[model samples]
Target: MSAAARAVVDTAALRHNLLSVREAAPGSRVMAVIKANAYGHGLVEVARALADADAFAVARLDEAVALRDAGLAHRIVLLEGVLRSEELSRAAALRLEPVIHCPEQVSALEQASLDNPLRAWLKIDTGMHRLGFPPGEAVGVARRLMASGALAKPPVCMTHLACADEPEETVTRSQLAAFAGAVADLPGDRSAANSAAILAYPESHMDWVRPGIMLYGVSPFEGRCGADLGLRPVMSLSSPLIAVKDVPAGGRVGYGGTWTADRATRIGIAAIGYGDGYPRCLGSTDTPVLLGGRKAQLVGRVSMDMIAIDLTDAGDAAVGDEVTLWGADLPVEILASRAGTIGYELLCGVTQRVAVSYV
Candidate 1:
C-alpha cells in the first residue's frame, strides 16, 4: 500500500554525516544528540544506524529509556537531567548519565542513595541562561556532587553555545571564554561545541562535540545547507499528486480564498499539510515544491491533509506522480525559510501519521 505521505530516511547518509562530524572535529569525541526522537527521524532507528557514536544525548529520561529498551548499550546522556529524586534511581539503573544543571538536581544527587553511582555531566551557564549553573557557582556545584559521591567519576563539565551558528558574533567567543574560565580547575573532560561549533569553532570542541541537526544531515546555520558542509541529507519528505484539475481564471483555491487563479491554471493536490507537519504558513505562490522534478508553486491556504500546488509549469504532472516537499534536491531549509521557521522545526515537526521508511 502506498502511504499518502512518507519520510524516507537514508541510513548511509546518517553515517556519512557522522563522518563529516569527525572530519570537522577530528580530535573530539562525538556525543550525538538524538533528542526529539532523533529530530523526528525515529529514535531507536537512528541510534542503531549511528551506533559508532561515543555517546547519545536526549532531552528527557523516557527517550533514554526508549534507547535502553531497544537494547542499545551506548552511553546515553539526559540533557535535561532527572526531574525528581525517584527518577534518579531509574536513571542510575538504566546506567544513564544526567546533566546536573541546577541546585535542585545537585540536591537530589546529594540525598539519593543508590547501589551504583551515576557518571554525570555538570552544565555551566556561561551565557545561554536557559539551563546550567552560573559560572561562579559551577566549581562549587561540581565539588558538591563530588562530595556527595553520587557520581561514579568526576562529572564531565559542559556548556551550550548560544551564538556559535553566527560565526561573526562576539557572543560565542565570550561564552567560550566564560566556560573555559569556569571549568579550568575542574578535573574532568570538557564539552561545549554543538553542530555549528563543530564545523566553525574548533577551539570550542574541547573534549566532546554534540552534533544534533548535523547528524541528520541538516545545517545548523542560516543561509547554509548540509551539502555545503560535506554532509548528505538523511530525510526526504515526499508525497504523491493525489488529485489534479484545472481552475478558471476568476476562481479562488483552498480555504479563505487567499489565492485566486489569475489565468486558467492547472493545480495538483499533494497528500501533505500541517496535519503531516507540512507548514500551513507556507501557503504562498513563492513557496516551491518539485512536481515530477519540475518546479511548482504552492497556492492558497493549506488544508489539514492537503496542499494545493500550481502546476502551470509542470503541465505534464499527473495524479500519482511523485511530489517532493523537501529532500536532497529541494532542501528543507528553503521551505522553512518560506515558513519563517528553521530546518530543525520542520524536521522535528513531522507527525505520527507520516510513514517513515529506512534505507
Candidate 2:
C-alpha cells in the first residue's frame, strides 16, 4: 500500500457482477458499458476482466480505439456513432459498430466508401430528448441506412431509458411501448434496458441489455444497494491515517474552525480529500468512514490533501491505521446521499491523482 490514497479494485467481484447481469437478462446479449474510463475503474483493466462479455459499449470513438489498441478483439459499439466522414472510415477500419442516432451520422455513413461495410445500431428517440431520431422517423431512417449499403447487415434497433430506476413512474413503460412500436417492423435485434431496466423491467430486455452502473456493483435505483441486488462492489477507496492527536474542549478542527470539540477526544487525519475525488461536502456532515473496522464521523472542512475524522468512537485508533471512505462494507450510495450526490457521480469523480490497484 502506498502512503497516499489508493483505490483497490476487485476483479473477482467485477466478474461476479457480470455473471449477475447474465442471470438477470439470460436471453439478452450483454453489452458492457465501459465508457468514461469504465466509470473511473480503469478502462482496459475492466475490459480485460469482462472479456467474456458479448460486446463493449463506449460513448466516444477514442475509448473504442483505446480498447483496440490494447489488443482486445471484442466487438465495440460506439454509443454516439460517428460525426464525420473520416471518423466513419476509421470506424470501419477498426470494425466498430456505431449507433446511428441522427441524420448527420447517417449522411456520414452514406457518403463514405469503406473497404468493408460496418455493423451499426439504429437509435430511436422514444422519449429521451438527448439523442436518436424521432420515433415517427424510425422506418424512414432504417430504409435510408439499408439503402446506403455501408452496413454489413441491418442495424440493431435501440433506445435509452429516461427513468427506468423509478419503478412507480409511467415514463419507462411508455418509452418501452414507443420503442417496441417504432421497431416492430424493423429488421435486426433490439435493446432498451440499462442497468435499472435489466433489474426492474424484464420485458425491456429484448435482444440486448446494456449494463453500466450495475457492472461496477453500484445500484441505479434509490433506497437500494448493490448487495440488495446481489451485486458485489468492485472498488474500495482507502487511505492511511497520517496523524492522530487529541483535541481539547473548545478546540477547533480543520479549515475555518468549523468544528469545535465539545469534550477532549482523539482525531485522526486521513490522507484523502477532494483532490483525490473524496467529496468535500462530506466534511462537517454526519458521514462516517471506517477506521480499523469501526465507524468514525467526519469533522470540519475537508482540505485539499487531508480530512479529519473524529475517532472518539473508534477504539484503539492510531497513526497508520487504514481508513476506508467507501467499499463493500460501507456502500458508496450512503456516502453519496450524505454528500448530496449519487453513486455514479462519486465513482466517476475519482481523479487520476489516486493510484488504482486491481486484485
Candidate 3:
C-alpha cells in the first residue's frame, strides 16, 4: 500500500474549461496562461491538454523554453519578457514572444542582434504598478520599437487588469480606457482580459484574451466558486484513510490538543497535510473533506504529513476509504475561503513529495 496522497489532474475537465473560456470570448483569440507550472497542474501536461488554445503565456523565459523543447508548436509568449541579451537571443531562437513591459526590455531587444527579428508585445501599465510602462508612454514605446527594427511585425499591445475580479471597483474600466487611449493609433492587435475579465467584462476582450486560473477551473472572483461560472474543476486531491479511532468525550486530538472532542467522536486519520500542498491554515476552521461521498469536518492542527477528520457523521467510513481534500464534489474555493487564502496558492503549493497522476 504505497498510496499516501495523490493529485489527480483531470484532462477532460481542463479541456472543458478551455471551451468555457472560448465561449466567454467567442470573438477574441485565447492565450491560455500556463505559468507557475500551469498553476501547479503540471506545465507540460497542461500545454498538451490545451493544444487548441490560440497561444500559451508563461511568466518566465524557461517555461516557454520548456514548451519549445517539448516540440509543442503552439505560440508561446513570455509574459515578463527578457531582462538580458542572452535571454532575448534564446527567445528569438525559440520563437517565443516576449512582452516588453519596461524600457530596459526594449533596449535589450534593440541591442541583441539576432538572425531573425522577434515578435513582441508592448505592455502598458494601466494601473497594475508591478510591470509595464506608463499608459501615456505606450504609443511612444511602440514607435521606438518599430524604428529599432527588432520585431518581425508590429508588436501586439496588452495591459493587465488589476481589479477585474472586484466588479465593484472602477479600476477595470479605467484600465480599459487607458489601454484604449494608449494604443489608439498603434498598428497591432490588443489583449487585456484575464480570467476575471473574460467572465465579467466583455468590453475588455479585444483582439485576444488571456485566461489563467479559469483554465484550471478555479474562480478568479471573490465570493464565488468555479461552478458559479460554468467551469469544471481539473485537480482533485485525495488520500486513503489509514486508520479510524474512537475518541472518548473530553479527549484531546492532534498536536497541541487544539481540537477537543466535545462528545464521543470517530476520527479518521488521512495521509494528507501541509507537506502535500494541503493548506496548513485550513484547520483554523471547520473545513469539510469528502469521505465515502459525505462531508467530514477536519479537526485539530494540520500536521506535516497527516490530518485528522471527524468522521463520526460519515456513516460506514473505514480504513482504506478515500478522502477527498478538494475536487469534483468538494470545491477548493470553499476550502480556500476557510483557510484564509486563495485557491491559487493551494493548487500551486502542492509539493513534489505528493505523487501526481494525469488522466
Candidate 4:
C-alpha cells in the first residue's frame, strides 16, 4: 500500500451485495454490470467477487475479452454492440452476447458467419431514446436477425427505464408496455430493470436485472442508504494522519487561508487529497472526514497531496490513526450529498495515484 492513501476492496462485502441483488429479485437472473473497472473497484476483482452472477455486462467487446482472459467463465454481454464488422467474429468466438441497439449492429451481425452464431439482445429505444431501434421498428429488425440465422437464439427484449428510481412514477410501466408489445410472442427472456428497478420496481425485474452501482454497495433511492438495503460497501478510501499541530485562535492553515480558527484549535493533516480522488471542493463549506470517530471540519483548500481538517475535539488522535474518507462507519452517500454530487461519481473518480489493497 502507498504511504499516503489506500483503497481497500473487501471481497466478502462484494459477495454480500450480490446476494442482496438476488434477494431483491429472487426470480430474475442477475446480469451484474462490471463496466468502468467495476465502478472503479477493479474489473477483475469485482467480477471474481460476483462469481455466481448469472452473466456479466460490459460496455464494449474489449472488456468482455478481459474477463475471458482472466479465466472468468460467466456469460458476458456487450451493452454496446460491435463497433465494426470485424468485432462480430471476435465476439462470437468469445461467446459474448451483443445488444444490437441500432440497425448498423444488425448489419454487422448479418455480415459475419460464425461457426457458433452469437446470442444477442435487441435494445428497444423507449422514452430514454439513447440507443437502440425505435420501439416501432423493433419487431422488423428482430425478424431480420431471426430469419437470417446470424443470431443463435431469439433476441432478449430489453429497454432502459428512465424513472425506475422514482417508485410512484408511471414512466417505467409505460416503457415496459412498449418493449413488451414489440417482443410479443418472441420466445425469449426480457431484461429491463437496472439496480434501481431490482430494488424499487420488482415488476420490471422480468428475466434479468442489470445492477451497476448497487453491486458496489450504493443505494439508488435518494433518502435510503446502501446499508438499509442490506448492502456492504466494497471500497474503503482510507488514509493516515501524517501530522498534527496546534494553531492559535484566528490562525489559518493550508492553501487560500479560507479556514481560520475561532478558538485555540488542533489541526490534522491528512495524507490524501484531490490527487488521490478525495474531493478538493469538499475542503470549503462541505463534508470532511471522521477522526477518532468524531466529525471534524475540513480547513482551507486541498493541496495536491494533503488536506487539513480542524480537529479541535478529535481528542488525542495519533499521527498514524486511520481516517476514513468513506466506508464502514462513514457512508459514501453522506459525503456525496454534502459534496453536491452522488456516490457513483465519487466512487468512480478515485484516482490511480492512490494505492489499492484488496481484502
Counting clashing residue pairs in each candidate, in order, gives 0, 0, 0, 0
Per-model RMSD to reference: 1.0, 0.9, 1.1, 1.5
Model 2 earns a TM-score of 0.99
TM-scores, in order shown?
0.98, 0.99, 0.98, 0.96
Q: Which lDDT values do the candidates have, in the order given? A: 0.92, 0.93, 0.91, 0.86
Model 4 C-alpha lDDT versus the unseen true structure = 0.86
Model 4, 227-248: lDDT tens per residue? Answer: 9888988888888989889999
Regions of candidate 4 where Cα sits further than 4 Å from its true position: none
Relative to the true structure, candidate 3 reaches a TM of 0.98
In terms of TM-score, how similar is model 1 to the real structure? 0.98
Which candidate comes out best when scored by lDDT? 2
Model 3 lowest lDDT segment of ten: 107-116
Ranking by TM-score: 2, 1, 3, 4
Give the worst 10-residue stretch by lDDT in candidate 4.
283-292
Of the two candidates 2 and 4, the one with more favorable lDDT, higher being better, is: 2
List candidate 1 segments past 4 Å from native.
1-3
Residue-wise lDDT of candidate 3 within 1-359, one digit each (tens)?
56599999999999999999989999999999999999999999999999999999999998988898898998899998988888888998889999999888878777778877999999999998998999889878888898888899999999999999985758888889988998899887999999999999999999999999999999998888999899999999999999999999999989889999999999999999988988877877878999888988999999999999998889989899899999989889998898888999889999998888899
